[model samples]
Every structure is written in C-alpha cells, then in structure tokens.
Target: METISIQWSLVLFTALTGIAGWTFVCVAADEFLGRAKAAAFPAGIAAFVLAVVGGLASVTHLSHPDRIMGALGHPTSGIFTEAVLVGLLCVFVAVYLVMLKRGASDGARKVVAVIGAVFGVLISFMAGESYMMSSRPAWDTLLLPLGYMLTAMPGGVACYLVVVAAKAKDAQVGEYAKALLVAGVLAAIGAVAFAAAAGQADGAALGCVVAAAVLAGVVPAVCGALLPKKPQQLMALAAGSLACAAVGIVCYRCLMWMVSEPVANLFLNIL
Candidate 1:
C-alpha cells in the first residue's frame, strides 16, 4: 500500500494561523463596530495566544534559524511572503491588544485593527499560494488561495463568537449568525473550487470536501442561528462551532493532500 504523506507542518501552520489570525479580525470588528466592546480585550488576547502558538508550529519544520533567515531574504519565495504577512498580523494584533490594555484612544487601536485585518487576509491567501508549484499541477490555482481565505473565516470568526456570545444580546448573536451564514456560503464556493480543480480526485476526497463545508461552514452557521433561540447554551454552541471549524479545516487539508498529483513525468512520457 502506498503511504500517503503530506507536509504536516505546513498543514498545521495554515489552519492554525488562518483560524487564529482571522479571530483577530472578528475581535477588531467587535471593537470597531462597538458590538462587543468589552469582549474585545479578552478576545484579542485569545487570538494573540493562538496565533503565536500557530506561529511556533510553523517553525517546527524550519529546523534551523539560518534556514529561516535565508527564506526571509528571498521575497520571491511564497514561504517568505507568507511568513512576513503572518508576522505583521502578529505585530498588529499585539499592538492592538496592548493599546486596549493601556486604555489608549480608539483611533490608535483602530489603526492597528485595520492593518491587522489586511494582514490576516493576505496571510490566509498566501497560506495556500505557498503550496502552489509548477511541479504540482493540482496545487496551482487562484481558487485554492480563495478557498484558504474563505474557509478560514468561519473558524476564525467562530473563535470570537465563543468568547463574546455569553454577554452578547440576542440581536448581537443574530448578527454573528448572519456572519456565519455568509462564511458558510464562501466556504461552499472555495471548497467546490478545490474539488473542481482536482480532475483526478477520488470520491473519498470529494466526500471529505463536502463534509468539510458542512462541519466548518454549515454547522457553525446553523449553531449561530440557533444561539438566539437557546440563549443559555452559549458555551456549548460556540464550542461546537469552533470544534467543527478545527475538524473541518483538518479534513479539508488532509483530503487536499490525498488528491495531489505531480505533473506526469514529461521525460518518461516522451519515451
């Protein structure tokens, strides 16, 4: 039997960073929009911790500090671009969190929030773009990056929901539910684009993609919708949404690897 393998570090890095960094985006929305102002500080801290943890996981495969520095020097490399973007995301988030703690003016924190949101989006796209290569035809597509950005939103936003929903009013919870539904739609588009790109993907891989959309996308949206009705079940619903996001993300990434195909050996084909 062929042992299917993947870049485990890359997978973890992409999923974790996407989720954690995006969580910051949601936290920023709460602060900027004044939906959950009080929750912003605590939620921001959660996002920072998770983002840092994910950043550390990405370093596991780097092996040496020199190799990391070398990669950073090459702006042409996708790894370099992704690393820079994620780093900026962490920096902005840290600044925003500190400003919140220091009781800085909203203008300062808002500036950081806007900057961090931009980085969050860029890093999400780059997470998948870094995987694209001429050698791997299956990995090269605009849709892959879009999928990375979109599917990640559900999980990332779900993290914020987990932290903020308890004190959030019914109307506020409804707004979050609406956001989840939108994320679900985006997930559908991105995940389907992923399946469409894999011309030779097996049924198993396709099935997993469908499952991912539901777990990472549909289930969370549904939970958010129900949360307004079940006001007392805040923690349970929020956690379930986050859990689904994590599992769905892993499932999607794993199936993506299973369907990967290198371009046919051109030299051998010509023989």
Candidate 2:
C-alpha cells in the first residue's frame, strides 16, 4: 500500500459532527425523560457550536467558502446540498436556545425539540453519506449510516445520564441513568457489529473494525460491567464509552478515506 497523508478537513469535520450529533442525542434523551428544562438549553448551545464548527470545516474542503451561499441555492446537489441544510438546522438550534433562555412557552419548546430531532437525524445521515457516496468499497455499505446513528444515540444518552446523575438528588434519576447506560451498551454493540461486518473484506477496513471494536465495544463493556454499583463508576463508564464510540467513528471514516481508487483504463492493462 502506498503512503498518503490523512485528509485533515474530513477528519476534523467528522469529529465535530460526531460531537454535535452526540450532544443533540443526549439533549433529546433528557427531554424524553422529563429533564428538558435542565438539558435543553445547554445541549442546544453545545450542538450549535459543534454544528457551526463542523460546517465551517466542511466548507474549508470546498474551493470557495464565499460561494457557500450559492451552493445552498442549488437544490439538486444531494448530500453536498444537505450540508447547507444541516447548517441551517444548527442556526435554528441556536435560535431555539435563545428562545429557551427567554422563557419560551411549552408549545414553542416542543416545536423546537421536534425540529431539532429531525435535523439531528438528517445530520447523522449526511455524515454517513459523505463517505458512502464515495466509490470506495470500504464505505459503500448500507450499515454505515446505521452505525453512525447507533454510536450517536449511545454517546448522547450517556452524556445526559452522566449530567443528571451528577446533579439530581432524586433516586428516579439514578434509575434513568441505569436505563440509559443499558441502552447505550446495546447501541454500542450494534455499532461495533455493523462496523465489523462492513470491514471484513479489506485490510484497511479490517483495521478500522478492530480499532472500533476495542474502543466502542470491549472497553465500555469491561468498565460498565465490572465496576461496583456506584454512580461515579457508572458515569465514568458512560463517558469512556462515548469517547470510544467517537474514536471508532473517526477510524472508520479515516479508513474509508485511505482506500485507494484505481485509475481509469488500468483494469484493462492488468487483464
């Protein structure tokens, strides 16, 4: 295999997007559990920051950032176009945070929540498509988006659980934390499985699969399963797992980018 430099823009973009997606998930899960008042504003702000940073990094990969507005004007560009759409979604999230700080009504909050969730899902898919759209066999699998979604959900939920566990005096919050941990574990397993299967056929892909499995699966499992019953331990496990998932996703993206594309007409000469 020939040596090549990693695409720093793509790596940074994926990392920021993962963080943003994870933050949104945690916030959404908090809302679902009736902790919206506490989680909503902070998570919204984090999401907005991450989304803006990721969006800007993505634009850096383009030939012209000033032409970004013109790119958004075009409606038929698919995932590339969706990049602008996700950026707009992040702006809405930022506005939602402002409204939240100003004491929005329940109805308004609900509307923002719904819109944010929709965009969260869209961003997740857009991240997956960024790689899957490439001709590389390592990333063309249908599982890529599913894996991304799974990792994001667990990472988000875990973060929310950790935050709640740290502050809430109520026993009910502990139960919720436990539940989210279990859910996160399951989601992590699914992500590891899908990534493993997707990478079974190629060397670069296999390396990604192994790295992800260790980070997203084995580490979390050992930490979460072996620790004594303690809130702090659980929180630590959750945070570690989230970190692992993020790393795994990055490795997956890097592998996809590393795969070499064949030159036109080279196949004819080889035969």
Expressed as tens digits, the lDDT of each residue in 1-271 for candidate 1 is: 1214666777788888888778888877766577777678777777778777777777775657446676578789776787888788889988888888899998888888988988887887788887766776677777777888888888987888888865453426666767876886777667877878866556777677887788887888787778778867777888898898888887777766767754443212111
Candidate 2 lowest-lDDT run of ten: 262-271
Flag regions of model 1 displaced more than 4 Å: 1-4, 63-66, 166-171, 263-271
Which candidate tops lDDT? Answer: 1
* TM-score of every candidate relative to the true structure: 0.89, 0.76
**Each candidate's lDDT (Cα)?**
0.76, 0.60
Model 2 agreement with the true structure over 1-271: per-residue lDDT tens digits: 5423466676667666655766665565555556434656656776777778877787776566676666567576543555865676686677677777888776676677667767776676667665564445646776766666555554555555455445542424443455445644655565566655554426766677566556654555555553336644655666676677667657755654455454332112111
Give the range where candidate 1 is weakest over 10 consecutive residues by summed lDDT: 262-271
RMSD of each: 4.5, 5.3
Q: Give me the runs in candidate 2 sitting further than 4 Å from their true place.
A: 1-5, 161-205, 218-228, 233-235, 259-271
